[model samples]
Target: MTLRPISEDDIQALVDERLDTARRSEVEAYLAANPDARTRVDRLRTLGRDLRTAFAPIATEPVPAQLNLAHIVEARRRPRLQVSAWQAAAAAILLALGGLGGWGLHGTLAPAGVDALAQEASANFAVYAPDRTRPVELAASDSAELARWFSARLDRKVGVPDLRSADCRLMGGRLVATPHGPAGLLMYDDHRGTRFVVLMRPMAEPGDAPMREHRFGSATGYAWAQDGLGYSLVGAADPAVLHPLANTIRRTTATNT
Candidate 1:
């Protein structure tokens, strides 16, 4: 039988492995003649392998029974004051020492929220990144399809800008939950290791004015908001390596919007 032209739905179905033997063979033959489609197939295959390996260990673990009943009664109980007297005394001493500069002292002592975000991004990157086969929900080779898949899941349009011209290649993207809402995790790699950028719609009130730069451990981050979207770029790379990519992303997003 002669092969039919591949539609977007057909490609998706093939990726989902819904095709029968004959149709699968037809698609394989078609992919043999199309390099881009072949690359996409290979990438998806890799992702399947990675996902299997990443999740296989969980299947063998036993579930605990007491974990459910112990928490059920606690939910209906009244709130308890758990603060110790010693803890309150220490807080009083600190407040007295801080005196009129308490606000400044608090600012200096408080953990930076941006740093927390960067650390979470990096830890997630490290865990999910080893899957060279399927590191993202949408591969770079399938930008349009990925955009469609992610946009629908996130309830907003998502775009993947090509940075290969700037010597960076798309590593893939994953869906992650954030305090604001569900966020898209798009990663890229250059000569060094992986760099991550998170895309999401802005929260009703992000609390403070816009923060441009944040440093956490060895990672650095940049955040900005425009056109009802929030963009955050984080990586262990220096400002020199990241600045250009940040500019490229900002420019591309700005132009397209």
Candidate 2:
């Protein structure tokens, strides 16, 4: 019997472990013959695992009383006979307090260059990490093309760093718009199935730290500046896990540039 040619969706399904018994075997056979597809599939599986691990604590934590939507709706349904001026003022004060409380729930209130980059990188990681189907706009097979495209878009010579030495394999990358201009985002995953992202943009100031660690909420990252370019390695993994990867990326990027 002739086996059908595998599509991108099939590879994604394999990564997600959604394929059936027969299909799984077929995909495994196909991947065994295609080293590139096998590598991409491995990265996708790693990303899925990392995403689950990172968000698992939130899943197990009890919902905040203020954030319980059902309870809030039920409370709203209770009748208020009348709103006196004093009661109105008290209500307004409570509303402001609620807003402040919500703001404080997201950790790290300070503003700085590294902090801003870390926030953006973390946001991007949240968006793309769990998506095994299409996390990157460019394929790893076209690394050279992606390099030229991103360099032109950013008006600088930036190439994708080879992170295999750090046991993290590059899946692909995507281009995004930032306040400074175009930024490049590259995705990678390690052997243990932890996902990480690297974001690069043009630096605004001349003097910035070569490397800085940042943490906000459950996110941990490292941001740095070199050669007038700002770089960040962001993920939901712990700081200990990300620090070494950040160093590896820094050295690789410096050499590539």
Candidate 3:
């Protein structure tokens, strides 16, 4: 039987991980064959993750005083005073998704320097690794174009690192905002769908530094710097397997400059 052409709804369902097993397999095959479609799927997946991450915390926080049942009832019973448009908007927002489902994130500051790079990479991994439909902003079939777009964003020539020796296929890349600045994110996946990410950004404080291992959440990876660009390789892969792979990326990117 012939499967219908992949549509936006299909892409969304893929990101949401709601597609049936057989149709999902077909969709994955289609994404692999079409770089542009895969990119769009990745983007849609990323946007969904960003929303959930942003709002999930807010959704968990205790109801504010204004939103409390007793307070709401009391306010309603009191004489209805004229409310400014701003106050009405704020109340509406509080009663809506922005107020109940998200908006709790406000206190923690992002890590600085190389630490930030590793954090960003790990965060990106968390955001993308589980996505089977589209995990990269660009598909490997368009690596050359992805390279150009990445370099343009960084204002430096950034070459996509070859990870074939590691049995990891280039899944393409995207530009991600970082504490330092905009950075390039290159993703790779192996035969088992094991995903690894390489994050590169221009260093501000210490442009050159030795490699050091780091851990963020469940991800174990290494971060280092050369010249003025900082790099972090992050994944849930075993440390023993990642160390040498990180070294290989270092050597390859070293020559790229």
Per-candidate Cα lDDT values, in order, are: 0.64, 0.78, 0.80
> How do the residues 2-100 of candidate 1 rate in per-residue lDDT, one tens digit apiece?
558877676667888999988888887888899998898889878988999999989878856655666656753433323455568767755643431
Every model's TM-score: 0.50, 0.56, 0.57
Best by TM-score: 3
What lDDT tens digits, residue by residue, belong to model 2 across residues 52-91? 9999999888888898899878776664434465589766
Off by over 4 Å in 1: 1-123, 130-133, 191-194, 206-211
Model 1: colliding residue pairs: 46-133, 47-133, 47-134
Assess the local accuracy of residue 107 in candidate 3 as a C-alpha lDDT between 0 and 100.
39
Overlapping backbone residue pairs in candidate 3 total 0
**Any idea what lDDT model 2 has?**
0.78
Quick one: RMSD of model 1? 33.2
How many clashes in each structure?
3, 0, 0
lDDT of each residue in 1-257, candidate 3, tens digit only: 87898887888899999999998999999999999999988898889999999889888888887779988887876645445665787556444322212222233543566776677677777776777887888888988998899789888888889989878899888887754568888898889988898988888865688888987656787999898788999989889989999999999888866
Error at 236, model 2, angstroms: 2.0
What would you estimate as the lDDT of candidate 1? 0.64
Query: Between the candidate structures 1 and 3, which one is better when assessed by TM-score?
Result: 3
Candidate 1's clash total is 3
